[model samples]
Target: MAVLALDPHIAPPAIVLQVADRERPAAGGGRLLPSGFLSTSGSQIVDAGGRSVRIASIGWNGTDSPPGAVLAGLWQVSYRTVLDAIVAGGFNTVRIPWTDAGLDVPLNGYNDRLGWIHTSLNWDLVADPAPDANGRYRYVTTLQLFEKVVSYAGQIGLKVIFDHHTNEGTEQKNGLWFDLGPGSAGRDGGVKGRVTAETFKQNWVRIARTFAGNPTVIGFDLHNEPNGEKGLITWGGGGPTDIKAMCETVGAAIQSVNRDALIICPGPFFYAPPPAASGMDPGFATPSGNLTAAGTNPVKLPIANKLVYTVHEYPDEVSDIARFDLAQSGAAYVDRMNRGWGYLVRDNIAPVWIGEMGSSLRTQADRDWAATLIGYMSGDYGNQGGPTFGPGQQPISGSWWLIGPSNDPPYGIQTEWGIGNFRSEQRDITDRMLMR
Candidate 1:
């Protein structure tokens, strides 16, 4: 593994060092230190004044309709509508979920999918086999759209985190090469497995090569939710070798090409703690629970010395049936936090950003659960050093980007399902998270 040197032109702002002293009363008598920047064993980010504000980012998944529709007149709103909402809602950053398919796929030509209209088209295709009536090559459309999205966000004062959501299929479901399953060209545990190391390197190389020198882009997430496969085997470490290699390969790729952005690697299954090496049986654990077992690779692999470990937390997953069953009341919900998220944080060997977490108002119970979870995120749960890793602090940065148009239906589904037509609320989440 190789470490990257910071470009002299883009040297990070000088970091302020806050020393830990046991004698100072202002330090909360060694309980909690003041709200000043402190040095850690990793990279540093500072403001213009050389102060590190606890990065309180607001993020959301940014994919839905095609870039053409977004730039064109889909729902009669520009991509800026979402960014504008973010600024209005007090946010400063955005995580734009982009797929490589738009670039990699061979397009035949540039024909408007919708009725003939003249407007801005955000997506571009690579023109592999030459453009046909359908449109340009997938890769070309992707690149054009990415540039536009990043440029637009930068113009509006929002930092952009380019997330490569899918490598093979669309960004909606089990499309990554790894999730292809049995008899597929890119099945799990195979050389082309979705989370395998080789695929990680290849995809990232293409991505890093493309985005080199772009300043607005913040970081790269190696893989998302790298678990939940039956009869699947990991690399030499018995954990997700592909996912870990992704951190190294993608980190190195970005560093080799563009060395300014941070590198983020997520834990398995929405950041759930992996099970023991023996693996968690189906009857013993839920679909979202860790399968790698308790003593497996806790931190997968570090991102070549400069990066942040991202973890996702949700009430639906992580917690066992006993805890969730009792979550009817606020007290039980807090208990679930301790047993679920708390354990993972303590045991996991990385500082984390709760990458994705949100709930909807489908039912009164659901709303109550969501609200309670939000309160915990806002710092209400007392520190409980129980179970595996012991007490730990909640992620200081994350996304509350999901907002539903109706109480029953979740909004921002576009980011997950829609290939090009991303919803405004989804983009709004990105704007908020990228806030400085």
Candidate 2:
């Protein structure tokens, strides 16, 4: 069921980290991502030397959950071991989804937050060597743990993207980025305080400044699946529920601090606009993949080529009459790609990251859907069209939905007793999905 990458006891081989700075020379250890900072060239994400880079990322969820949190498996295994396993498993990048409430957990409070990590396996997390006067300093803040996660990932050659999964450990069902309002259901129902648009942007700015020169910290995924429907989360209208406007606003704010930071924007659930004529059919789009609105009113940021669009494609294996195509491949999903946001790749609009996607390898429908979707992004169109993996037209790249320590039926990347482990089958699909 679950496959262990290495012994959970031993740490990965210790290697000296040569930080990316003028003070030190560029380090090399066969890093998967390019050495320099990343920028965009039309549709391609290019390194400083202008070589194209494909973002093969895996979304690591759970810290975005309610109450205080830590990166999932740290309680069962060492953070070092789990992170090393990510690289060993053949992934180049990792996306850490976090909530504001989790970020506010203080150092001393982490004693309770880290759960079982208080054991000797991850001593550094609970208490680090400290100044003699203070006996021992406890580096126990969730924020500190988050920074350590970023630092070690970079040291070991994996780039990171921190996603604002939710504001206060509560899902944004209301579709408003600013205030979920009173009786918002979770995170103590604004007992800590409500999340205003300005405060949200400022929170991101603080995170950006925290990792200012860290090359390993690549980008900020502004929001996770602003999956609100038409009446709720519209794009570009500049209304209260305008996610497009919010992305640009928050993105530009983060850039004011970390200018080189890549601003990733995810739109609302589906773009079903009112019929141009009285009786026309409503349009459909993947979750957070509302590029129909973006096509006409593209997100304009302060910096050039710094904007990237992200979408989640949690497609059902079988077609639903409710949503057309659904990556079922019968109607030439590539044709849909050409007509939809996926067209951004062929047209070289901006880089599109499939931010989240996955399925159980059990059923044939699931298998076919996974293959077709990954193939589409990798430029294979599954006999629908020719592959377009080249400079300027680099195939679309993205993070798989998640990796968890559970069987999770249709979507888990890990199998039974999955801590310090992963599913070999999922790993195989991930290998194929990664951009070469």
Q: In lDDT terms, which candidate is top?
A: 2
Q: Which runs in model 2 stand beyond 4 Å of their true positions?
A: 1-31, 107-115, 127-139, 180-193, 271-282, 317-327, 382-387, 391-393, 409-411, 416-421
* Candidate 1 local lDDT, 1-436, one digit each (tens): 0012223233222211111111122110111111222222322333334433233444444333233222222122234444443444444455655444344332222344421211122122122324335442332354555565666555555556656565443332432324433423454332233444455466677766666666556667655554434323232243443344445555766677666556776544422223344333222332222323323443333343346666554444223323434443387555644443344434443334555654433456545655555555444554534222222322345655342122223444233222234355334333333323
- At residue 100, candidate 2 shows an lDDT of 68
lDDT of 1 at 420: 33
Candidate 2: worst-modelled 10 consecutive residues by lDDT: 21-30
What C-alpha RMSD separates each model from the true structure? 12.0, 6.6
Instruction: List, in order, the clash count of every candidate structure.
Output: 47, 1
Q: lDDT of candidate 2?
A: 0.64
Question: What TM-score do all the candidates reach, one by one?
Answer: 0.61, 0.81
lDDT of 2 by residue, 227-281 (tens): 5552455666565556777888888888888887689988566534423321111
